[model samples]
Target: MINVVGFRYCRLGTADLEETVKFGTDMIGLETVGRENGSVYMRGDDRDHNICYFEGDPTDHTLGLELADFDALDAAESTLTTAGLDVHRGTGEEATARRCMGYINFKDPSGNSIDLTVRPFAAGRRYFPGRDAGIDEFSHIGLRVTDPREAEKFWSEVFNFKTSDWIGWSALMTFDEVHHRFALFPSDRPGIQHINFQVSETDDVMRSNYFLRDHQVRIQAGPGRHSLSGARFLYFYGPDEMIYEYSCGVRMVDDTWRARQFPVNDASFCAWGSKPDLSVLEGPDAAE
Candidate 1:
C-alpha cells in the first residue's frame, strides 16, 4: 500500500504568463514567489509554491501528489507497473517542474496526468497572505473520474486510500490522517474537477465570498455547507477557468474508521444553501 502524503501542486499551461500571475496573486489570494523563463510560481501558506503557471498551449493541465518518502515512491512505481500502467521516471526539466529531488509520472485510469514526487520543495519562509481570508493550506482535490466505481477501487485497492464517505457516486478519500486528500466524481471530461484550499471557519468562507464578489470575480457556488465532509465552502472561478474552493471544518479518519457509504443523492451532496452548480460538473472540453 503506497502512503501518499497530500496535494503538492497543479501546473496549467496559459497563453500569457503575466496575466495568470496577476490573477493568482491579486485575485485568487496566492502570493507570488518567483518566475523563470516562462513559468510563474505562487504559493499560499508557506510552501514555496502550490500552483505553477507556465506559458504554453491551454491544453496542458497536470496534477502532482507527493508520496511519504522514497520508499513510498518506489512502492507507487511498482504498483503502477504491476497494474500494467505505463510509468515514466521524470528527467531534467521534468524534475524542475515539481522542484523535487525525484519524480515518476503516470496517468490515472481516467487518463488524468499525475506526477508522483518525493521531496517537493517547501520554502523555509513564512507565509503572509496578500489578501487574507483565513487561508490555511491546500486541501483535497476534486477529480473528474470517468467511472467512479473503477476510480474508487483503483485508489482504495491499489493506492490504499480509505474512503470517508460517498455522496452518490462521488467518493471522498484519504490516507493516514487528513480527512480527504482526494475525491473522485464521475464526469464526461478528463481533467481536474476542482482544486480546494481549506480555510479556518464559516466566517472565512463568507469573507472570501464577499471579497471575491467585491473584486468582481465570479462566484461559482457556495458560502454553504457540504453534507459529505460537512465543510462550509465557497467555490470561485479563477484564471484559465480553474475552480478554486475555500472550505473549513473537514472530518478526519483513521484505520478504525468505517467507510460511510451513501447512494448518490441530492441531500447527501449539498446541505442547506449549496445549490448544485453545473459549471463544476462540466468536463474539460465544455465551452468556455
Candidate 2:
C-alpha cells in the first residue's frame, strides 16, 4: 500500500485566469500569493499555495498528495507501477512550477489526476484573506466516480484510505485523524464534485451566506448541517463551473471510531431540512 500522508494542493485549468483569480480572492477569500507565466497561486493557510488556476482547458484538474519523504515518494511510484498503473515522474521544471522538491503524476481508478509530491513548500508568514470568510484550512474534496464500489476499493486497497461513512454510493474516506479528507460520489463523469474549506465556526458559515448573497454569487446549497460529518456548510459556484464549499464543525474520528453506512437520500445528506442543489452532488442531470 502507498503510505499517503495528506492532501497538499489542487491545480485547475481555467479559460479566464484573471476571472478565476478574482473569484478566488474577492469571493472565496483566498489570499493571492503568486502570479507567474499563466498561473495564479492562492493560499488559505500557511501552505505555499492551496489552489492554482492556470490558463488551459477548464476540464483539466490535478489533485496533489504529500508523502512523508523522498523514500516514501519512491515507494509510491514503485507500488503504482507494480500494480500496472502508469506513473510519470515530474521534471525539474515541473517540480519548480508546483513548488515541490519532487512529484509523480498518475490517474486514480476514477481517472482524476493524482500528483504524489515530496516536500511541498509552506509559507513563512501567516495567511491574510482578501475577505473575512474565516477560513481555517483547505479541508477536503468530493470526487465524482462512475462506480463508487470499485472506486472505494481502489482507494482503500491502494492508498489505505479508511472509510469513515457511506451515504448510498458516496464513500467518506480519511487518510488521517480528520473524519474524511476525500469523498467519492456516484456520477457518470469523472471530475471534482466540490472543493471544501473549513471555516472557524458556524458564525463563519452564516456570515459567508450573507456575504456571498450580497455579492450575487450563486448559492448552490447549504447553510445547513450535514448528517454525515456533522458540519455546517454552504456550497456555491465559482469560475469554470467549479463548486466551492465553506464548512465548519466537522466531526473527528480516531482509531476507536467505527465506520457507518447510510442509505443515499436527502436525510443522509442534511439533517437540518435544507436540500442541497442535487446537481452539485449528482452532476447536471438532477438540475434538469
Candidate 3:
C-alpha cells in the first residue's frame, strides 16, 4: 500500500484569473499565498498551497495529493508503471507549475489528472484571513468518477486510500478518518465535484450562510449537519460553478480502531433538516 500523507492542492485553468482570485479569497476564506506570471496560488491554514488558478481556458482541472516522501512517490510510480499506467515525471515547467520539489503526474481511470508530489511548498508567513470567515484548513475534495467501483479499486488498491463510507456506490476514501479526505462518485464528467474547507465553529456556518446569499452567491446545499462525519456544513456555488463546502466539529478515528464502511442511505447522507437539493445533477455545472 502506498502510504499517502494528505491532500496538497488543486490546479484550475480559468480565462479570468482576476475574477477567480477575487472570488476564492474574498468569498471562500482562502488566503492568496503566491503568484508567478499568469498563475496564482492560494493556501488554507495548512502547509501546502491548497488551490491554484492558471490563466487559460476553464477546461483544465487537476487535483494533487501528497505522498510521505520521495520513497513513497517512487513506489507509487513503480506500482503504476507495473500496472501499465502511463506516468510522467514532472519536468522544470511542470514542477514549477505544481509548486512542489518533485512530482509525477498520472491520470486516474476516469481521465482526471492526479498529481503525486514529494515535497509541496509550505508558506513561511502566518495565515490571516482578510475577512472573519473561520476557515481552518483545506480539508477534503469530492471527485466525479464515471465508475465508482473502478475508482474505488484504483484509489484503494493502488494508492492505499481506505474507505470511510459510501452513498450508493459513492465511496469516501481517507488517509486518516476525519470522515474522508477524498470522495468518489459516479458521474459523466471527469473533474472535481466540490472542494471543502473546515471551519472553526457552527456560528461560522451561519455567518457564511447569510454572507454568501447576500453576496449573490448561489447556495447549492446545506446549513446543516451530515450524519456520516457529523460535521455541521454549508455548501454554495463559487466561481466556475465549483461547489465549496464549509464544515466543522468532525469526529476523528484513533489508532486502535479499524476503518468501517457505511451503506448509502438517505438518513445516513443527512442528519437533521432537509436533504440537500443540488442544482448541479452529477456533472460539472449541470442544473437546467
Clashing pairs in 2: none
Write out the backbone clash pairs for model 1. 168-264
What is the C-alpha local distance difference test score of each model? 0.78, 0.88, 0.80
* Worst ten in a row by lDDT for model 2: 279-288
Candidate 3 pairs with clashing backbones:
none
Top lDDT prediction, candidate number = 2
Candidate 1 per-residue lDDT over residues 264-285, each given as its tens digit: 4455556774676644333233
List model 3 lDDT by residue over 1-288, tens digit each: 677787888898877899989988889877888899888988768665788899986757899988889888888899889888899999878888788888898888888888998888877787877577898988898887777788888888987688876655677778875778887856876888888989999999989999999999998777888877789889998777778899998777655546555544445656876577632323322211
Q: What lDDT tens digits, residue by residue, belong to model 2 across residues 1-288? A: 887886889999999998899999899999999989889999888899999889999889899889999999889999999988899999999998899999999988778899999999888899999899999999899888777788888899999799999876678999898889988877777778789999999999999999999999998887899898999999999988898999999999998889898865678789998986554344233312
* C-alpha TM-scores of all predictions: 0.91, 0.96, 0.91
- Model 3 misplaced stretches (Cα beyond 4 Å): 255-266, 278-288
Q: Which sections of candidate 2 miss by over 4 Å?
A: 279-288
- Judge candidate 2 against the unseen true structure and give its global Cα lDDT, from 0 to 1: 0.88
Residue 283 in model 1: lDDT = 29
By lDDT: ranked, best first: 2, 3, 1
**Best-matching candidate per TM-score:** 2
Candidate 1 structure, TM-score to reference: 0.91
Candidates sorted by TM-score, best first: 2, 3, 1
Model 1 score (lDDT): 0.78
